[model samples]
Target: MQSTVNYLWHTDDLLGQGATASVYKARNKKSGELVAVKVFNTASYLRPREVQVREFEVLRKLNHQNIVKLFAVEETGGSRQKVLVMEYCSSGSLLSVLESPENAFGLPEEEFLVVLRCVAHVNALSGPKDSLPPKVSPRHEAVPGQRASSPLSAVAGMNHLRENGIVHRDIKPGNILRLLGEEGQSIYKLTDFGAARELDDDEKFVSVYGTEEYLHPDMYERAVLRKPQQKTFGVTVDLWSIGVTLYHAATGSLPFVPFGGPRRNKEMMYRITTEKPAGAIAGTQKEENGPLEWSYTLPVTCRLSLGLQSQLVPILANILEVEQAKCWGFDQFFAETSDILQRVIVHVFSLSQAVLHHVYIHAHNTIAIFLEAVYEQTRVAPQHQKFLFEGHFWVLEPNLSAQHIAHTTASSPLTLLSTASETPKGLAFKDPAQDIPKFFPKVDLQADYTTAKSVLGAGYQALWLARTLLAGQELMLRGLYWCVETFQATCRRTLEVTRMALLFLSSSLGTERFSSVAGMTEMQELKKVTELRSRLRALAEALSRCSHSITESQTSLSNLRSELLKNRDQVHADRSIQQIQYCLDKMNLIYKQFKKSRMRPGLGYNEEQIHKLDKVNFSRLAKRLLQLFQETCVQKYQTSLVTHGRWMREVHETRNHLRMVGCSVAAYNTEAQGAQESLSKILDQVSHQLLQDRTREAQVSPPLTAPYPSPALTDLVLQMQELCEEMKLLAFDLQDNNRVIEGLSRPPSAPDS
Candidate 1:
């Protein structure tokens, strides 16, 4: 039954009730718009006038979408009592939704995010302006232990309160009201400012206020323990409440409860809240005179995933700290929560590639990243992976989403095909989103990594030292033709010799393919080859240890060489050059004015501070800039020149050593190749004799390596040479590393100004 109040509002429904006031759903008689009227009883007036006035002011001053709108204030005719007319949320409080049996175990993963965003983002539920991470997946495949996505409770309203310099000291599910937004979406709002207060971030509040279940340990001690209210509370007290509220919404129950429960053992509950170590969630037990037994885990009835729990546990444990000092402020809490929300878990179902049946992806992943993941399952390169969309083949890319293909609903698989089988004969794509990818060649990461010209130099390390003799002082770029040409020729010869060494190795060692052709195991040769490999590997390690001092010198020289390389044309490419120029200009400008310009460096730099920088380093003040120029330019360059000249000798010696090894490898290859040929021909003859007569004894004596290389007097010399073929690539990489050393020795000079 409806009741009329002062002929102004008709009380159509009873919304909710607290100790002081009853919220009733009412309709305005004049405009017929619905509003919530908070009718205060005699108990409400028992509070101080200051608290009441502050509450009213907070409601009026706060202007945000997440806050409940204050409509007007009115009084009843018969009782003559105060009533606050506020915006009526049709969807009711989050408390009501949690009360639903379906939500008894907390919201599904999807609903959990909606609640997460409603209250906050990827931060405070704001749009993606540094709020959510770029890859928060809205849709997800049903994986074991992963809760399906669903909407639920939120914290943005509380974030807004903190932003507005107010704290909703009471942040519980009941205080979070919800309204039906467009498309029937729930828009949660933070309400009930009776306990809220305007408090600065650093300022403290003396009074103990807030529901005991969600209160900080300090507040609980005073409120429930009946301790003296001497402990001060900061804005972080509200963070404690948010953690408790979030835990409740996520698991449909309060986190901290003593062995006998809060009501049964109130003092013990206080002990449970305070005594636990930091980052402990859901502290369950500790009765006096009993062994303490507690759990740091959420209840299994909760719907959040293990992945989510891992992410959520740290947040709850940090924010719900008994000690305010350890508690996370709004910023840290918001950032961590925002990061979790920003990750999008896309569900992919491939059509043609059956192995890639279901997969998870971050929405922000580019085509290359997405295909790499696809390749892990299908063995098809990303370039060859084409997803079927809109009657054509479109690859997974930054732009391709569940929305475009219309398989957004769960259980629908994304049709997938591999172009690796060869381009689909009649497959077509329009390429509207510029997703028409180009073919890419197979990549060698190691080769590519060492290929880029080192900033220090780009030639045989020894040639750089030789350049000093051929060209005058290292900075003399014009006379370095002989040095460059010589470096190129040495580099070419080293490669050609290395190839020769490799060819001999392959011919000597019988590979699996070689065994098929030769028709022999060559067991004796294979055994010797293994021993040779072990010996060579040991030798390589010894060489590395001997070159340790040279390696350190190279690193230091390389850093200086990098700095020099940045400005081959020092005035344009060099950053330090520009700084020196700016320092000089400022000094010259101040001198021309006779130091009369009373420009002081601004307290801080902004667009307005440009004017203040002109009068800097005037009169005697200009001397420091000259020192800066000498240190940053001439002095450093000169030091690098001396260092490079010294390191060049070691570089030249190392280059000579490598070339000598290469020449030896070439000689060893000839002996190895002949032995391999003799072994194969002998095996063929033995097989031929056996084929002619099964009972005949066949003699097999392969040709011996007459001029054996390195390991002398070895019948298995051919096998050893062949086995080292694969190891030779490691030698090539070592060669490349040494060649990349700082070799561009040059003389230092002043910046061309």
Candidate 2:
């Protein structure tokens, strides 16, 4: 036996030492497994035998996922010392993690939540831990066996002790150890129950036992007396210590302190803690003469999101209150901490000017989103989105991970960098009243005879006024159509963001094997259920508003561009025979040039062809001059003044259309940002519910994949069908994002217009 012990463990491999025992790293010879062995000192052997027996009995009986396991016990030969074997936690104690420099302001939100969910709640839930699908994620191990006692403590820490009627006199950070799993997942376990004692009922007392800084005021006051004070400690002592330990974990400092430090002046620490103002939850007075400051708020620099802080502060307050009568009972603390564990977290994004948007995401989502948001709102590309975290522009190096950034990443707004700018030319409003004089040119009757003889003729004035005013109104109509299309586009994009989030959550429920743990289920029911319902109803309402946004444009520019072009054909040359002959000759010359250019580049238009083109140009001008001289060609027109009324009406109608379109676009961005927040929150809620539901359902259900599902459960088919529809929508959203990214260099080619 001595030879095996010598071979398995090295003499110098001491892990830690204390007054009662020294822990050493060792391995099992038979199993080839690593373990820790604690050998008692000579003096510990001389103590009362039941004290040692009670310690071992507690370790053996309290088996939980959150409690460390007991492997076996053996004695070393020659030394006559009793040796205890225990599970080895490769990761150090929780104190070591808190001492890290980055955590000087407390854990980042991501890390804090990990600790909150896994260690803080300490639930004795059913089913195995780390139940996520093997290929998709790493596994977390649960305790090897079940607890012999009832699982009464949902908020069990000391609740672990509370359930077993055991009170751990010391519940500080150093006593809480961490175990690293094979996959590198760490599980926190309540350890070192050397001062723990079992009670018969809820109301019980014992001699004061704990570290000074974390000890409750009642316990500390008695512990430090020169002549020991007569006072009894109960299960509630653990509650107070639990509060202090958690506060230290959260903000990297103790909540209550006095002159100098707790170690230097333990009496002062007791007075400050027990004699604070009625409602104060936390306090510290660093100097002997310094005034004490008290408040209910967590330090502002703590990485918890504002939304989460609102939930957690109340829980901390109830537990940490100096007034013992007001402190929350065990059941209340359990329920509240469990609430913190369930819900998916939310992060806030603040753009310049304190405009905030909520999203269900963390720091690891993507860097592209910030740049996208800037471009989408401002149409400003070539932008650099400098991220500010911890008061400096966050240089996102490879080492700076999403977890380090905390739970601040979320659904981000994005826009394409357009190489070509697009300004949708909507309706143009013009007053024909100002433009009418160009057609008539204000001139005295005698002056017009010398300098403006051509314009003075009534026929020319009537023809010009009708043609010019009609042309201007036709252009405005084209712009009005463009505005209608743009509004339709914005509406569709908003709907897609909302729909995709819901679909992804639904699809994930059907496809994945979710983690079955405490609090996983309730996070599924976020308060945003009403927000989701409101958003759906509002979508239908928006359709009508968008239609009204373009209402005036439709009536004002009712004519299509195709109709405007076709109307021009009948007006040219009025079907005269001479004009038809001239058009046919021009068409013949154009066709010859088209044939030459199509067959080869720069091969058309020889010197002979150029000479013919020059002759044609000279002949056309000469014919036009001859027309002015001939009296028979001169024609007369009247009522050119009557076109003024029609032109003025077109101008007024176009302006009204422009006003409505402007308002719709101006309001779109604010609406989109709000809708994004509500949808993101709703998606997170549904995802948690699905995970919890699946975990509980899987525990007793038949192999859902058995050759056939249970014949009595006919709804399985319906469930599968609903999930299939959700999966299809989720797939479409993913593919859409890919398509958008690929097309960002240029827009997709427009269909033939």
Candidate 3:
């Protein structure tokens, strides 16, 4: 080993001493280059020659930017140890920089980005693809079955190493070194591969390998701190080391600190392997909401300005997904970073005042919506709306101007936004009625009045529809109030929702998955129950008003019918009994018709089926009335205009009949009435015939005309009676029509139209 060291680096000077080796700062006597030298300790006598040969073989086969470079080994006569020589870096280790603040070792955001890039680049170089010499058993696990490289390179290099039957057992950051190349750039070098091993070798695996802090928890627990090696576990030990390295990089701390003696190592290992990682011990802060909160200072050098901190938290959280399998790997990390950087660059270079102007103009719209919403919540105030519009415009103009500042970045965006919020220029001490001087009085009028009215109408339609369909009347009212306030207050805030939706879509935002079917079921039930309650209240109010109106109309019609009958029965009256009865009937019929028109419909379990049954009954009623009218009155005109008109009028009033075909004049018969005695006999015969013939057809179809004559009732009583009967039939028809309408119409709270 001494001769090999002399061959590698010619000179050596003692620098420090350690348990395993004597370290020195050395220079190549021949080449005048600096290096480090270490001589094997004399006290270690357990197969020293074999260990030295193994170390040389492993180190020589490994080469990486992040790994320390091995030069040579030499042996000298009369010396009890061999010497190992390697390249030396002047800046020392990350450990030294952390321990001493005086090293002037502070990295700004940009510098930090460079560091991360360098680390990523180094990990890419010495990855697991090198074809070198092999040694030991289970080469996939070098240090008792682990890798001897930094955790970052383990997984990437693992499959390649395993394919070639090589394993690194001592994966840790300390063994990783950074070198300066042509441009004074840092490069990584992976060093100290003494514990590497080969697969298919049947030697008993020793547990006394690998750094205690970096060992896999399972391995540590079973190895019992090297007291008695356990014969379990596999190549996943490298994953544990990788986890440890990530932990350190994210939070500048080890998983655990070493303390006590070698026996303490056993306790530490057992704790690591058995206990779960205490998340609270890490530097990531936590709020009551439970999501991890990063400190104000970010570790990476991102292009986002300080003002954009809030915008960046979510991005970071996604990249650092808590789930190990879901976490971003090299490809994902680089891709996402490149995307963000591109956006930043484009924003800086290509952005013009036009963009900011558009944004501010859009903001004006959003503010308008906000104002309308506010008005909806409170009270309608046109003055307030006008004030808000003017104020918003005032605030926006300068903000837009500021956002257009040349070379604007994330840091300046918020600043410009804030500036807009503060000055509000023309709005300060300016009355809305007094149109501000200069800067778009005409444009402002168009945006605030003409455009506002159109936008408000459309926006209100959507908002009200959503509220009425998904919420209740009260909520619908609230939505209206909100729209009005939005239109009035912020003037431009109406566009915020549109912008937010676009941004979220671009961001590829995802929602968390629901955990159970029971949760979904409960949500559905809650919605149904709420809707049911609202419907019940609305139905109750409608029923009450309908009942009262029907009763009042019924009483009024009864009195009027009585008055008509009394007038017809007067002995001194000149009118005939038939004429009087006709007049009274007509009056009664009109009264009944009016009363039926007032009746509203109800809803519930059997409402629909009941409505269908009523339709059939109404057809029967129409037939009976037609029979009575034909027999009682003489038809003058070829068409029964009154009957047809009444039917058409009823059809118009009946919402259910609106879509149905109206009756034609040809469907009604024009026949003269006979004398009273002869008419009675004729009525009986006609009624019988109608029952057997017309009733059947009528039962299956709607009548084309009212079943009463329009002009044959000279006597008020007869007219009133005929009118009453006709009205009764029409009333039934109207009620049935209403029932059908109520049945077909969906509940007010139905989700979709």
Candidate 4:
């Protein structure tokens, strides 16, 4: 190790070490300013000379807040050692935060946003100069029309890089440094351009070098396969690596791991080239043989809201797309991120207003009724009560503009009354008759008042009604305000969570692997699994919609119950009860749809299915069948599987259909033997022998490969007939469940009946 006083800059402490370089905390000997010195051992280390030169060239051109600034470079010991002094980051690398137990759940959503901005900045800096006009120097001021508050600030930084024709090939959590803003906010900077390179006019690069986990699938293919034609890839490759980095920062884990172990680099590379990354979609089952044992749960410590998760998963998906044409560029990514933030803000604000409107409408009616009762009892005119309420108490504004009453107080009761009289119609107050018809059509107020009096005894009832109305009004307003605040907080949290999840999903599952004859079968299966998973997602969404509808109906029912208790109107209560029952019926239909959709069997067993199979012989049989299928079909037809993609699709569809049939059989018959026999029959019909025979014949004769022979088609058609018969039995069971739901949908029997 070099001494602190060995160079022009005095080294204070060791920061970190990598294969080619070691970074140290240092200060300028003259200026005494803190800095980071990345020292490379050119003679002893592997690729240190090349990396150091590359870093020097790239850093010399880039000068942005997000990209690390190069302060100075020094060479010593006859140029055997090279040191590049750069801006010191006190907050350390993002990897430190991700590794911390304190931040085990990953960085908060806001921090993720900072990271995104940083990525966008790097990408912008790498863009073609002519395509984007020159902005203010990034080191001095932010770009015009760019708000520091906007996450899009990062995009400006990336645009700068793009214009300069630089590609930061190695983008990962470990390479991203964090700086603390004056406000204590995180400011991320993209550092370590060791693998970065400048592209030529052809706009393509052949060199495949980056961290293994962050490498794009195409890059992996280029490097591992060593195909000259496929070696050249575009700048979009950087987006994939950034996506991976973002995901790791968000989820505190890499998206793709080697299937077996860390030593399986070839396997990992092959997987990267040939398949979709594992754990990309939220709430889906990961393959058992998948690289990592991923938690189905999102980070509990950094818990993201459902809304954010929904927005982010798709964004990452788009960026990490395997098809370069389908993948998002800097422009699309910047637009999408901006849209996500804007949409979330708008949605939260809109939702808050809608809730406030609901509360205001209810509160306005309650206050009106309370005022009317007071006027009747005290012989006070309605106008006098309205004036007093608007000025002294609460205003009856349907829009909840009553919140501003404190700021817009009147001089006296007389002045308030005059102001109200002059106020525009429907602004401060509306005709009671008109409002009453809108809220409660054809309802007689007189009858309601009479019933209320009878329920609680006349004199005491008016006092109770007044007290209840006043207390409820205050409570409702307070609750409404609280809900708005809560929603605002949730929305903020959701935005962060979504940003993080997008990064995670993108890194884990975003990139598309190349298709090869060897892994074609797995790819086909992946496609089938993806299709089934989508249906499952649809089922889950339907269930979520149903739950939301039920929640709304329940809230309305609770409010109606409160009214019924206070007013004691049998007719109104009955009518409201019927409406709730109708809601229940609608919910049942949704449930039925969910159930039907849920029958689209996943490639692997879900938690529920796994639990159901526990301690059952069927579980063992299913496992055996799965193993046999993998061996017989997957292994033998692995190469030809690509050629027979349609045949493989049929196989998966038949397998799922068989599983469904088995489930039905197990439900009706306690005898495992019966279910086993059904599975055996289905397996035999779609067995490896049939697939093998077809494959062998195809290899022997090319003409037979075009279409299935009459005998084989006849056998497949007969199997389909058997499948239909089994489905008929399951249909009968479905009908039974539907009949039970129908019975529940009927009107409730009266107590007298």
Candidate 5:
């Protein structure tokens, strides 16, 4: 027995006991590495060899960082009692961490995050590194066929085992070991394979095996195993066990109560089959062919806050998906876990900031209310001599509450800071009957309330207002965008009334309205009305302020779009030009060859040869010139229109602004209409004059019968030349029209200009 232990380990020590094995810690005799050895008890070894083989295969193939390692297996004396050697985890099980009183189970949040990240990484790398290599690596490999497709894979670590016909019938928190590495941090490892089994086993071993707290309802399914195996057990049963484990981690206790009966097995079976699972009892198993109530498992006592509870509740529900098909696969599990973790981080940060803001503001508002009450009750005070020079006589004496103002001999300024509403003792200052109403006007109160509601509803708008209040120009542009959107959403028209409202709101954020009681009430009513109407004039003013930037952004976007289109067109134009040039070059080359051929035939002096060469060369030159002229005209027109349109839009927007400021829309309209009429008149006159000139030329130019060409061909050539000249003239006229449009559309200048 000592030799057998030496063969497996260079060093060894007894650790503890399992249901069927005596566990030991050891260092590899060959490699000087740590491992665990399980010497199976005689009674369990007599049951089946297949159980041991299944456990061995499952552990060997699982090979995840989160899973405990099974190193080697051997038999002792006879094959009746076998021993399994696995990796030794120094940190021990989670149960030890939770149960030990020295460093209580209150794990640090950072520690929890580390565990989550480690589990996620392991799940992602679950499969073999590659298909070509049969040997598996200790490190996770994202090889094909090994990929887990869900975020829940971190919680449910079954893939290869299920595929190979093995099941970890018992999975629980105690079975999960925390291996300490490098620092004091604990790395989780799933251990204890004694109660696991294979699907193909024919032996008549009892199915009820896992710890009571972590067992699945399937135990009841197995109880009627003699009914000819009506249902086939699958991977989901293991997931149910994992769900129970997570519940224990979160609430620090079992979700269900233990059972009691005369016969332990019969009672356990009855409890599993009949009891309504705890409200928080979650796992990957769904009730099929049976009725079962689903809910959250209740805590034994009050534990965490609602927010913290909310953070973990959704995660529990996802792990406890009832339908097997809908259950999280490895890929989905990893993605979801990453997403939830990120959200949780953000929420925690935001909640902290919000709580701070709430506390500070609440204190400030309470103090302001208390001060106002004190000032109302006071008629005179020691500060009256100072008030004579300062001009405002309504200062609340230090430590003055309303109750004190009504009764005490003297008031304190601090009295105003309390939540009490009555006048404070001996509070003496400016009397309410003399001037309180005048200072705290009713209109101011109403305005304040309305402004608050509007600003609150318009979060983005409020942010813009805050930026302005802080005197930030860069943020103002962003604020303006929100303001404009808000105003547009609220108002029916963009006009002076809306612009003025925004202008005022931008400067003071409607704080003036709340300086008095009346204004506060009025403002509140106004806010509710405005919210219902979805209208606010300040938004328009905000938009107008941001107009320059908005216009610029729009112009930039348009220019970019235009430039892209222009580039595409230029490419097409270049291609066309190249094709035309190629054709022209080919024709020119052909013409030269034709001339050479013509010249070679007759000692270079024949009239027909000279005439043929001259005609072909002229035709080639004319085609090249015409193509160049047409392309030039197209490019010039396209370029001019794109450039002019930007200026035109700017002018048009300015004109609209002027119309809003009470300028006559008709005046602007008249100018545009006049420009259009003038352009049309000029085009008509040019057309008529061109026609007259053509007629005169037709009458006076000599009939084309020169250079020995036929009269008909000569006339046709002259007509074609005239057509080209007319088209060129039209291109120039179009340029003139573009300039006219630019002038007409430009915004009006200042009166001084």
Candidate 6:
């Protein structure tokens, strides 16, 4: 790399090259810190010195983080080049970031707000007499009788060239550097003041300089009219450039193309003065069967919130206004945007936390209820003479009478006394006393419940910690949705056996042997079974109701989704039509303005005005102006029609995606309805079996020991258990579908202004 070696600093890398200078990454030999050194060719002598001195004055006085800091200047080498040592922005320029594919969405909205604040700060500092460098004269260094204005008044004043103070003649993305701060946040610094100059109070600034694409409309008028002496621009010209730069940074393209064909300059000037720049509307475009497009050549603002659009559009328009009086001052721009910036910052930071908290509470409660049901089923002892526990062979020792053994043996080869070894591999029953305790170890049922609850609570707390790092609200909500579904699935698996056990208990309660037992213990056990049966029936009924609601919601959401798509298409169509009408109206206004202000070279000019305007052709200029107006109107009208068609198609595709989501929801509802029906039937069958057993018990003699549940009851329990397991899985589906429908149905929150 070409290096610039000074007494205190030595360059190690060439950072960039420009027309007037080459920038290098240099290190201070004394401090060993990296810096940028701009080496300018000073062979032209006075011109380079003046520009360097003016820039040095500005940089030396600026203490703000948003403006580049100057270290020292040295005249070095045989060629008499001036080397400016400055702060090194390691991350390079904002322009580089904007052009990178990684930042296709443009800079974050927060960063744009930061840039606006920086601009406002710069304007504020420039207005104050004390803020200017001690040795440098202020542009409006008061004439003998002129009174000094307040700082606010001075900042807002743009009518008088001298009163408006420092205007950065060249403001563009490439001139803004992005420094990486200690916190890893980007710090933007405005640089390159080579084109800057002080203005006199006696006259307006007449210089036609700065980047052409960012040049003010008044500057264009002056240039095109070839009457620099007749009109001048003030600090509003800098505001105009600021608007162009902001637009380019946000959208990745210039509002006006300053360079093009042979007649590009004239065309650009005409458009700047009389037409709205492309990409000013913030939306994406689509064409039927064609590639997706943008209303503008480059559109970075697509999908941005409406509140941001509302603020940005007017601010940009006011800055780029043809009339300087209509242009916004820094104060006005700040007032218009500060509330919006604050709201956006808050919304961006708080949304994820809100969504996560909401999901956690619901998931935690559902899991708690599910675990309780599993604990209840496992803890209770079986009342039957023969029962299966954890797929193990078990016979109630006290209840296994000769009659129970005969009944069990008659129904299957396995008798009531069948050993665990006799059971099939997969069907071998686990000892409930041992195996069940392993899953819930505490001797006290309450203690086991408490322990499980604490662990679950801790897990949720850990989830909250992890959620702090998540970026977006929508992603967090989706993640929470999955978590809830997973928990529901686990609950369903655990509850499968519990539901069957409850059904068997209900069936046994109606038997003569159970009802005729001559003790309070039997009656209490019967009462407990009766209550459990009621609760199970109620639960099934509730699930059936939930399934019904889910089906209805899915249908409603499908309709709402279709309506939203239609409404969006209609809104886009209306906007396009309105824009076309606006263009035609503007064209007519331009025509009227042109007719009233058409130049009459001989009749209107005073001696000096005529002499200064000698080369101008007023008649030809009017004809060309009319031709340009016609062309601009035609272009805008055609673009609007294309944009309208694209929006309609885009909306159609969006609706199709929503339709697919609705179909998936409908499929889930179908499965959920089947599960709900199965559960209801299981409840009804148990109720009927209990009633039959009660009638039989009243007609027969009481048994000495509790009779074994009939083979029919065992079969019914097993079947109900299987159905409950299926219901558990179906419940998960129903829950997930419900959440999806809710998400689709919920209206979007309006962006805070």
Q: Rate the local accuracy (lDDT) of all candidates.
A: 0.51, 0.48, 0.35, 0.46, 0.40, 0.44
TM-score of 6: 0.42
lDDT of 2 at 478: 27
lDDT score, candidate 1, position 691: 42
lDDT of 4 by residue, 323-342 (tens): 77566665666655554443
Tell me the lDDT of model 5 at 56. 69
Task: Give a tens-digit lDDT track for model 3, residues 1-753.
Answer: 233434343234454454566656776757768787766766644555776577677667655445567888765445636777887765555433322211112222333333444333333222233233222222121123332333344333323343434445666656555456788865545455566655332223444457766775545654444455555433334444544543444334453443432244456434433433323222221232233322333332122233232223333433323333433343333333322222221111001010111011111123343233323322333132211111121122222222222332322221111101111111001111122112222212222232222222222222222221222212212222222232222212212221322232222112111122123233333343334324333433433343344344334434433533443343223322234244334433433332343353433447435433433343333333333333322221112223223322332233122112111100110010111122233323433443344456656675669653223222322433343343344334433334433332221221110
Q: What would the per-residue lDDT of candidate 6 be over residues 1-753, giving only the tens digit for each residue?
A: 333454343355678876677788877656678888888754434464566578777666555566688888875555557778898999888788775432434455557656655555454223213222222112112235533323222233222222345567777778888887788877777788776666543235666767655677667566554544566666556777777777766655566543341134565444434455433422221232232222332342332333355456766766666665555554555444442332211111111111111100111122233222222322212221122222233232332221222122111222111111111111111111121111132123343333322322222222222222121222222322222232233223223322333343234333433222222133233354445435545544444443444444345445444544554454334332233333334433333333333343323336335422321222223223333333433333334334333432433343344444344444434444443544445444554555567558745955466565555655555554554555455445455545545444222332221
Question: Pairs clashing in candidate 6?
Answer: 286-646, 391-428, 391-429, 392-429, 392-430, 510-693, 512-697
What digit string (tens of lDDT, one per residue) describes model 1 on residues 395-463?
344434322322332233344544333211111111111221211232222221222111001111112
Q: Which ten-residue region of model 2 has the weakest summed lDDT? A: 134-143
Error of 4 at 425 (Å): 40
Q: Give candidate 3's error at residue 689 in angstroms.
A: 77
Candidate 1 scores a C-alpha RMSD against the true structure in Å of 28.8
What lDDT does candidate 1 reach at residue 141?
26
lDDT of 6 at 598: 35
Error in Å for residue 352 of model 1 = 18
Q: Candidate 2 lDDT, tens digit per residue, 361-439?
A: 2233333443333344334452433233222233333333223333343322111212223332211222112222121
- List the candidates' TM-scores in order: 0.46, 0.46, 0.35, 0.43, 0.37, 0.42
What residue runs in model 5 are displaced by over 4 Å at the alpha carbon?
A: 1-13, 28-33, 75-81, 102-107, 113-166, 197-208, 220-232, 258-308, 318-344, 347-753
Candidate 3 — what's its lDDT? 0.35
**Local accuracy of candidate 5 as per-residue lDDT tens digits, 1-753:** 332543453224667776677787765666777777777777665666776566666666666677788777766544535667787888777666544321221233445444455444443223212213222222222324443334434434434443444555566767777877787767887677665655542223345666654554545445433333444444445555655555555544444433332134444343433454323442211233233334563342212323334444555554455444444443444444454343212111011001100000111122233333223323222232111001111233344322222211111111111111222121011111121011112223233233322222222222222222222211112222222232232122223332333343243223322123223233233334333112223333344544443344444435544543554454334443344344445444444443354434333347445545544454444344344434443333334334334433433343344334322222222332343233334334433444555456667774485434345434433543443343344334434433433333232221220
